[model samples]
Target: MSNKAGSFLRNLGQFSPLDPRSRTLRLYPLKFSRPKISHSNWNLRNLLLNDFDNGIRTSIRYLFQDPFILKSGDGSLQRKGISIATFLRVDRHHCPRRLSFDSKHSLVSAPPFDDGLKKVNVNPEVSGGAGLSKEINPPPISYRKLSQECNSLSDVLDIFSNAPTFPSSTYFSAMWTIAKRMSEDQKRFEKQLMFGHPAFSQLCDQMMKETRIMYYDHLLFSLYAMVKLGVPQNTLVVQTSLRMVQERINECDERCLSVLSILLKEMDKCKNVDVLKAGLRILVHQQVWKIESIFTLQTVMKCIGKDTSIALKKKLEMKALKELDRFSLLNSQHMFEALAAMNHRSVALLNECSKKVIDNIHGCPFKILVSILRSCRELQYYNLDLCKGIADYVATTFDIWNLKQILLFLISFENLRFRPTDLMDLLMKKVVEKPESLNMRNIIFILYVYSSLNHTDKCQHKEFLEVMSSALTGCLHHISSENLLKAMYSFCIMNYFPLAPLNQLLQKEIINKLLTSGDTEKNVSRLHILDVCLKLDKVAYQHAIDLQLPLPPPSLSLSHSKVAQVLSSLLGGEEYFARNVQLPNNYHIDFEIRMDANRSQAFLFSEADVTSTNLRRVAVLCVPRSLYCLDLSHPRGFLAMKMRHLDVMGFHVILVKNWLMEKLKMEDASMFLKTKIYSVEAHPTTDVNLHNTY
Candidate 1:
């Protein structure tokens, strides 16, 4: 060995383990003002000299300097090159553990001979007043490593605070991965900390000020995760991500649109949301044909919604039809609902869907049937084979369903104007078997449906329903006025009137509730109608004596519907045709025309004209879309009853439907109205043999 190296090796051995002065030796610890170690001077602290290796000698001091870490806000935690360095502490005692290391996998070397700390070390009194000026280059900020090691939100803050610029896409993904691994509770807590804690906000601002190299999916997913994590969209991070989405919308695809669909509403409330939504729509309009997934297409349709331009809706509808065959039996409900949200559906598409539904009817869920049924009405797409299959399935599966299932099935069917005779029989028995499952409203609906079906004394339905009606008398105190009036109306229509129920409903308090109801005009008209029904039964007339139901409501103003306006302009004027004319028996007529002798001249007729025999009255009622049966040509009992009532009241009935109004010009609408009125005069649709039936 060289003489100098040999001398240094011999000198290293001079500090022997058995030295007598080791018992009470003093030491100094290294300290720094901040993590800026490159130019920071190393401060010192005095500590006890006592440290031993399993009762061995303590002549030589050993220390470890952990890595000088610089964590990033949103950087990946899985980084390489973090090494701990073992070094020496001159003195220390009764202090918290401090660990630091270098990024280069090397230990902190001892002070060189030229340094002042080396000379004063031999005599501690001289170094006690001196500080070390050694320039320690701080470890490189390996944020990727910090992100990979992140176990908490605090770690994320460290990375964010130290990052020199907005994190790149990969770094953000790594950070988000750390968050994803957290438990629900941890995520919730961390989310709260991010938005509620100002320090975190300030720390994240620097790194999330702008999206750096984030693509469409990255931006959307980050925004989605942050919102789902409880970070409000108003935050700078979320806003920046949203802006990036607009800037990169052309780069987005179906996956991106699907994610955006979920955040559409939430993001709508954020700042500058209009530009974002419009931009998204433009992007969607451009990329819609590229979407093939049925669910994604459905989401895209709903995201576009009903209020968008006609061209967009038509594009979406065409796309939906192309993807219709892609739907499975369970997901068929989504397809139907998507089409229903729109004002139009292709008849051929609906027919094909109907066939497909019936073919797969055996596997369809009960709730799915309900949605399909309801959507059929909304789209006015009806097929008897499909209806029959659904009815048979529901009737066969009756025992497994709850009351809600049965009622919803019936409600949808009722709207579609299909009387599920088989299902109704099964449902009636189910209700009789479980009366507790049937609430007051259920009973009232049953009564109304049974009455409309003209089932009085023909079968046990009349008796069962009468019993059900009597059972609701006990609930009169809490029963809603709407329900009570409905029950009474059903009984009135069925030619059966219960004195006790009628008396109880007419009580001052009940009458007040009915009069003060939110829908007062309808209620008052109903009250007058009930009074008229009571006059048919001598005994029931007594209950109407002191009943101060309001006078029959005035004929309603003409609606803004193009059909109504066209009908009025062709007839004469709004004043010439009484709109929303109500009969004494509560039959609703959309427009009432009083015809003179020879049916040449027409006069306006009001509710008071119900007793007029001098004029041949014509009732123009708009059969609501719901009143149309699945056949789309026939009316259900709800509507059929009105027709029967109008026929019995001695008025020829005419029906109006506002279909294809968008494409119908004023002249076509006027002709449509003329044909509708004249066709009824020549031959009624609801009552083909009206004069013979009456």
Candidate 2:
């Protein structure tokens, strides 16, 4: 053992130093020395063996310097000992000038480049391999072709699994291609990519780092994919995708703009105001004329509300309206809704849109037309040509409209004061055809329009009133107090009441509720009930005397007193006249009289009687010729529709020109009142009895 140990120590090129204190032999320290190998003559095994002898202290640089050893296609150096097998394989086969290592075989082989693949030379600087002069570059494969070649989802996952090794653009391109092909099967694709496989999540993480350089389409595809995958909007993935869209919006084409619009709408659905604002800013700055861009601006305006600056809203509104001609019917309709929501009103823009609506009225759907009409009414922008066109369309297409739509159309027309009588008649016919569908509010609106347009005496007015009355009686319990009052008011204005049974039902069921309920905050008030009762009661004197309702004091002003004195003498004795009777709603009737049971009268003695009923036969409003000649359309005109609320409630409304009353003698005044009120054509009788008051 001692000799063997000594010999091994000697072979290790170590010398023993004598110990002075101890006479015994001590172990010497071993020294290691590498054997020099000739690079020109030695085989790879020898070099490897030499490296092994030195405990494998060889540097990668030294291995790369070997001439026989070729760099692998991936730029990695071949294993030192393995190069011998690669060289032998190449030498024996007499392979082509360029060789590639078979990764599976662990040996060199001839190039297996396919003829279909076109070789591309990648710049070394781009590849970050300054030493590499040339290499077998990968073919520029398109996403479409890649998707075609990938037979299964695993194949797609394989590409994503190796995403870190590939360039970001190449990886994103592959992903985009796969996503496009799988778009038709979005639910399946989403399941597999988002949940079924881990590679997709890993790839997402890697791609996020390179989002700044991602192409617009690639970003859009990623966003769409994530959205389809049901990713939460608050997630980093969705936020990154939105950021990428906003960044590239300016350079994007129309298709990209559309994608951005869809993205904004989705964000709006998510209530992501910040992201929506960012995208809208980019769209507005780009001034892209595409319809999608316009819609995006509109959506942002709607979603952000007052958070969106007024200046910004106006800018976007102007920008969107400039392209109104390019908008389709559906687009125009959506634009109108958006504008209405934003409360953006431009007369010129409204005119342009109105023209478009008129041109395409026939093609427009019922709901869309209703929306347009409502928008116009909300904006208070009434275009006569547009309204007439809508009316014509409604007249022809009334059958297709639902009950709600018919009511909306009619109410819009009434608001604009653009009465289309034919269309209105058609609407009335439709309502009568399906009276069961009419709710209390709809009834009120219909009656209101009829009264406003003065169509109470039209041919079908009585039949229409009967249908609405029946409908109202059936649903009296369900009617709200406000709607009930409005319906009664409408009935008064039209001067066409229901028959006895229906009238009693309305008075008992609807009017009783209005009188008792305490919801006076809304439009309906207590005074409306008084007017309704006055219109409903055939004999005004019996109603007042029985109900114990006090009459309003007559106006004692000079003009009113003069007219009242003449009216009193003509009708009967002064005791029959009551001055300025105040109703529950603060309305005052001027000089109401107790006439014969068949003809009850409430009189507005002069143009100054602002609260008198307009029902021609039930009430008389005497106005001077100057006042009568004024434009009735003016809000404050003496003959304006607003002068009376009781006209539509079966009241006989009369507007008497009293220009000659001031100059006439008492007998002349009596004759004038007789001819106007009683329709008396014969000479007056000598008897001054009150029996001739009728």
Best by TM-score: 1
TM-score of each: 0.58, 0.48
Instruction: Quote the positional error of residue 270 for candidate 2 in Å.
Output: 8.5
Model 2, 266: alpha-carbon shift in Å? 3.4
Tens-digit lDDT track of model 1 for 360-395: 887687767887888888887657787888989878
**Candidate lDDT (C-alpha), each:** 0.57, 0.51
Put down candidate 2 lDDT per residue, 582-676, tens digits, no spaces. 44334444545433324434343342243433333335565553332122222221134425554544344445455556677777666656555
Q: Which candidate has the top score in lDDT? A: 1
> Where does model 2 exceed 4 Å of error?
1-213, 221-231, 243-255, 268-272, 275-279, 286-342, 402-404, 411-418, 433-457, 476-520, 523-584, 588-694
Clashes of each: 23, 29
Tell me how candidate 1 scores on lDDT: 0.57
Report the alpha-carbon TM-score of model 1 versus the true structure.
0.58
